[model samples]
Target: MEITDRTFPAALVALSGIEFPWDYNEKTEEPAPSNIDYEPYDEFDSAEETTDWIRSWTGNKELDGDAFRMFGQDGTGGIATLWLVRPGQPLVEQPVAFFGSEGEIGIVARSLGEFLWLLAGGVGPQEAVEFGSDSGVPHDELLAVARKYSGIEPRTPAEVLAAAREEFPSFNRTVESWCR
Candidate 1:
């Protein structure tokens, strides 16, 4: 299926329902690492909810988040969404972005396909933006999904991240400008 389809594709719908292994660490005797905090939702968040979240996040009532389609959140309430920056393009063609509850904002992938590879590379939205934080990732469960859905060849997390950042170099500043 095309990644940029108008509707949320079946791949994404299935991804949302995946019960990722977020269990406690047997080696560390601790809860799952905070970096792997992504929890995909059963469905995309409503536009109203997205607007409300953006308003709350930026403390700007005038701004609406209709441009974003939030589908997951990190343990700290950071939002992972498709950023509709490429006007007139299909939704999946737009960049994937992360808006952390703690004021982190960055582009995670250039498109939905890259996003699948990012996941396959063992990087969650939060980890993708936190610079150097690692979560002992690469959840093998998601590789099949990535391979099946990714239109491009598999790439490393670093490659996915660098390409995304380069494509949307001004994303952080853009979001920061929106903040109150």
Candidate 2:
């Protein structure tokens, strides 16, 4: 049911510290990506480490592939997903590069949504929501970004692409700046 199951079995296990099949898309509202590599992973150095690592990945769209969705598999089905996409990506080297970039001034939600949308391409529902919420972009802008990327408008793609083009450099710059 979780989107990570479709592509990132390792990240799931590493973060959850639990074992379960990564294949359950057919039964859930979210669908999995057809192209995925489900590989085995070793346990983290510590459960607490896993928890902290996963918590840091939250809200960071740059690491969606490595993000963790935390929720009770049995309690709230909808709340059971998070994104670690930016974690292992090359972009990860520049974690704080998202501030003060052009096109960064849009609705906060839209900005965050645009950020996540750009980072992960086509992510799951729960992950998308979490990304937008975590970005701290703004509620209204997030909604707009969601609506735009939610496939509600034909122009949303163009809008998102524009935002990405504008922000990518800044994101990279932020990384470069931070690294120095």
Clashes of each: 1, 23
User: Candidate 2 residues 42-149, lDDT tens each?
Assistant: 421233443543334343323322333232221123322222335434221111112111112111112323433332333222232333322221233233344544
Candidate 1 residue-wise lDDT, 1-180, digit = tens:
223333675668868867755555689764465336679987788778989999999999999877888888888799999988777777777889999988988898999889888887677887788743244467676788988877789887888888998888999998888889
lDDT of each: 0.79, 0.30
Give the clashing residue pairs of candidate 1, or none: 122-138
User: Which structure among the candidates has the greatest lDDT?
Assistant: 1
- The parts of candidate 2 lying over 4 Å away from their true place are 1-110, 115-158
Off by over 4 Å in 1: 1-6, 23-35, 131-135
Model 1 lDDT on a 0 to 1 scale:
0.79
Error of 1 at 69 (Å): 0.5
